[model samples]
Target: MTKEMDVTEKIIELLHELEHCTDSEQKQKIEEMNEIVDGMDEEEFESFFTLKLFNKTDKMIEEEKISMESVFLLLKSVGQHKVLMHSQSYAFHSSSLNKRFEQMIIEEEKKKEERNEKLLIDLCECTVLLSNEISSELLSIIVTCLLKVALKKDENEETQKEVEIALLALSYIEICKSVKQEWYLNEIKEIIKYHQEHHNLTHLAYQSAWQFLMNRFHFNKSLDEVIENELHFSRDATKELEALIKCVDWKRGKGEEKRKKKNKEELFLFRWLQTLGIFFFHWRLRNEECVGLISSVVQVFRASKDDNREISDKCIFCMGCAAENRVVENEDLLKIGAVDLILEEMQGPTLDNYFLERHMKCLFEDFRRLKNAEDYKNEEVKRKATKRKVFDKMEEEGFEDCIIGLCHYICLGEFRYFSLFENYPEYFVYL
Candidate 1:
């Protein structure tokens, strides 16, 4: 341990002396320091990793010898130093990595907007690569830093574009650690203050900002305030909010193309919608008018069924609740085809239809709540166009009897509602 301590002191001395040392001395000392840092001295683990010397920081900005362009190589070589980076004594300045980044960006802010895009791309890649190892406190340090740069209040067109990309990329951090609390409304509210000064970021900032608010706020704010702000939002913000509201309102199995594309994105976005949905349903949007949002969720669950089983099942179960909501509110999601899509996905073998066989009672039982048969007997509801629409689109592709059975179902009344008796006798078809 003494030997390691002596060796580290020597390295620090060599680093400081590099300014005055001759070429030979500098080269030899640098190599010697590298060897010691990388050496297998057991007690040197914290020393080697921390690299904090004479109250200096490990963040490259503090090291005058290293330039911004070389930060990547330095971080890659020196790596993270928990003791040095997080130690209160040798901490990064309030600006930290972000300050240095903005300094570099300021030189190019007016010249080109996309210039800093590569840095954002790199930050996202590194975040994904290191999410597991780095402390959240340290990660939040990075996040706060990036937010400052990408969200610069006086940003011009070029900077706004770069910040937008940065917003999209930074969202990859999936875990919140014990050491760090999630940055919520305050972070967003701070960004909103920037909008009046530089409106170009209104659209891009709003995408992530509204998403953040949706995840964080939901019904916590007054419903009238939420809706009024939504209705009068900076046009771009309104679009994003509507998209979010649509998602929160998802029922069970609504959209086709979207549900089918449920990739890694579906895993998180649907979860966001689910959590936010619960918040609103339980808090602000209690009236029946708000029951319409389930259509979006149903579509997501139906589409993303292949990505996650547990989440999909939960979504299907949610559909039962939404159905109940519709009944209680005298809102007919089925009339708008929310129920019909669920029924179609339910009858099929998609993984998202977990509640299909299980929750039939809950779904159909909503019917008992209707005051009169006419509530469920609208011409379009009785017509049931989804089945016919599918058959017609597939007709040219050649499913003669399938089309016939569909047509028969369309024309037949309560006496012969299904096809088993008529179409299957000539030829049996198994689902």
Candidate 2:
């Protein structure tokens, strides 16, 4: 039988060579060390290191005898490698690693859906603690694996919050040290940005069970997407909201009641207008900036053929909202013909003009004209067949009002290729 001293001596030698070991050689040594160390008792494992050195070091730490540099190094050595992507134990002894232990975290988190977030919360705490204390190399592996778990759209909201908290903790810690500070800070920020942008992120956790699975999946598609909804609020829906969130704010203040009630729908239209002003003002040369502008700052860019069209879906909702709430008090906005423009766009094969006109009249605002409302109808018979049935009926039922609105809309708006508003003339917000 191999003596414990022999194993101890071998581990000590490999550990001592940590600084000079090449990657392949270091991996080989670690594998060998794992073979011996795997079965060792705590006492035997401790024997592998210099006892006097550990004792003196522990005593110094206990007695506050160590310098700051020493403490930091101690943290970097062990804590830094909090979790590796593939644990050597898991890689080597696949059987012992077992479905039981590996599935425990995932299964526990799965059951947490709609129940309680305890397990997911604990996972977050563990991940964050590791992030703060682990070695950079090991932390990278852990973070990448955890991100795969955390960013999954199917993941529970609790799990997402957990990830956010973990990133927040890392962000805070990175704000502390100098050596590992910048790298760590950037990593956490990127993760946060990814979650904010991605639709596929929560797929691992949420799957098909989430209510937001279809409608609210990923985040707001765009500013207009929500505005078109009579109910959903626009991200640029409010001054305060626009400054904070980057995604479309479709559900801003979703369940909240009014302080004094001044037509939530109309007020939301103002939010939409404010956003329009913003995007138009921010229009510039930078590509990303242009997208941000139309999506949040200016609404016109929604029509500007570009990428991220799904994101621009919010513009439809906002337009619908504005069309729904065409109040006389907002004549200045009406003069811009936002509703008229939106209605014209909706006149295609897929659009239900009758529904639009019905909703349009719900606003109680005076519409300017309908002289060109039919122009929006497509020439394709098959395309217009379904839409005409709905729109033509609307013309029959409320023909006078729809025509009035259309006329008012066209005459009211001071047509311009792009809005002249400086706040969001035609560009990205000054982010």
Candidate 3:
């Protein structure tokens, strides 16, 4: 017999022995199989996975000759082998085998059978490792099955692991093809809603799923084409942005609460806002949609100040980016209460030079744009009235003095406003 044939037979034999092997022996047998697969040349690796392994596993599963544990171990061992994964045959083998594996998952889901978590994870890992090489059709099937597992709502350790792997897989999927379909876009929307609404999804799973959708729409090339085609994602993005803004309870407490560190949920909310901030910075939405997004970001900036400096810093940064991006409308500035928030932040007791300067620059830019946008001939009266209101508010809030004090530091070429404020008793707030 040929050497390749000999290796294939030995692999199949080990898989059979793995079925009934003791837990103690299973690891040894799996290692032995890994050693063989790891040693195969490109052609042998391709032939073994494409021609030998799938047929053996299919028959073994059909005859109940393999335990789920054994099947998963075998599949994981073979699928993760360096030689096989790097082989030219990877695309064909991954697509065909993933399709077959997806069918079994579908059947199990239909029967409501409790699946092995390792099996699902291994299945997902092997497929995702295919990267952009795997067929979009096969990816859709796998993603559909995994989402079904996640939405099953079993609410246990098993469900958490399932959802975690599912989200991890989603994060790795290349957006080249699947995102073009309407149904796939709807699925993305549904998953976003589910993450925001459901408390059962653990932080890891929640973050994974959010990071996936965030990256897909925020950074992927597919999103460029989607936007170029005028596909509607702004509404969904805006809704989620609104939910993120409203979810934080910044008024929950003060003095004593200030001593306590942020809880996991609070931390996740603030961090995800940072992620969304990056998304909004790059995403181009219509003027009306930009209106809602900027409004929400300003709300977070206003309320994130109670006790959490980190949250406050993040929200402040987001607001600055929103303003810098010109998403903040001059007419809507006062209506959205951003101007008031800025003045409040400038006058507030706690002062970080960087954040204070950011708020100042945003307000300055807004005022600058407001002045430039007024039509000198026709809107002269309206411009004077609006300018009077803004200047009057600035004077009432001592914002002019704040600006003068800030300018003093600027003129001195000093970047450390806190130290400058320390010597000026009027500007200093001693903790």
Candidate 4:
């Protein structure tokens, strides 16, 4: 046989021997297994570990040759073999192995044994290593179990650890784009509602909700039903606005000294904003609510301008969407100084070219509409003044200046490529 075939045969032999060996003898055999694994090249190593080891475990579970607890222990023991753990071979079987382990956890949860719960928690923690391999169906199962553990009432230190690990796992699983199971959505809603009511889990709960929304938006699923039906964004506008503002305010700390720790909170907050912008772009709101939302988002954009360009860009896009909603008029935007805020933000070095183009297009359209409205008003004034022998052109002059100013901003530098100016030379010359 070739060297590779020989190695494979040897590994299979060792695996069978280790399975039959007593617990004490198994330790020495595991050490020998590790030694054998360490000697193989990358491809052979992955093949032996994933295909051989994983398949053996599957057989052991199916045959009742080993308890789930014992199998978990065996996996843990082999995981200590650094070569196996880090190899692409391990990654090859990680999803299947994780799916099996998660299934075991779900089964164990029905028993509600503290030991089993602890094992489940440990297994959940270990799954992070293989998170990228987790499939959508497996992710749904994992999230369902983790949410149960997170919501468990046990307040002991160990239980608290379990809850923390479960939350972490939920966070990782929450971002899976392919997870479209409605059962998962229902559980996530429960977690959000429970945490929103209970002060202790509020932050973790919101984090989970944020991730779920992001995943939903990524898959192009509609969130309007969820927001309107479950979240009650319209019924509880003030409370929801406050919560959103709190999320927006979670900024990364300034300075190199304070930057050692990750800004995960801020990162999650931006993700929440992005999810909202994508899925709820045209959500209707009252005038007062619109003002609050617009103001808070603008502040977030300004704060993120220098530190996080992506967040700033997303904020601008979301705000532009909000502006388009019929509930938020240009007059309301002007009253709140939104136009000035947008203008200032646009001038910043961090503004992206695409978003800047979008911003200018919006402004050009709004100004052009306003100019037309003023022309109609001026025509009425002219007709009345001609009959009454009076004249007035002041408002028309001011309107023309406003249109010219907007055109100037639009035509500046690279923005001159805007199709509006190209399509209508009359508007440009009137400037």
Best candidate, TM-score: 4
Candidate 2 per-residue lDDT over residues 69-131, each given as its tens digit: 333333222222222110111121122212222344455545634633444334333433333
**C-alpha RMSD of each candidate structure in angstroms:** 16.2, 22.9, 14.1, 11.9
Per-model TM-score, in order, reads 0.39, 0.23, 0.52, 0.53
- Model 2 alpha-carbon drift over 4 Å, by segment: 1-301, 304-313, 319-328, 349-431
Clash number for candidate 2: 64
TM accuracy, model 1? 0.39
Please write out the lDDT profile of model 3 over residues 407-427, one tens digit for every residue: 666667566544433334322
lDDT against the true structure, each candidate: 0.43, 0.35, 0.59, 0.53
Error of 4 at 132 (Å): 4.0
lDDT of 1: 0.43
| Comparison by TM-score, 1 against 2, better one | 1
> Compared with the true structure, what per-residue lDDT tens digits does model 1 show for residues 301-419?
65555545555665555555554544233344544445455445534544222244333433343333342345446654543443344334334334444335434433453233233
Error of 3 at 380 (Å): 6.1
Candidates by TM-score, descending order: 4, 3, 1, 2
Clash count per candidate: 17, 64, 0, 1
| Top lDDT prediction, candidate number | 3
Candidate 3 wrong stretches, greater than 4 Å? 1-161, 168-210, 216-253, 257-260, 374-385, 416-431
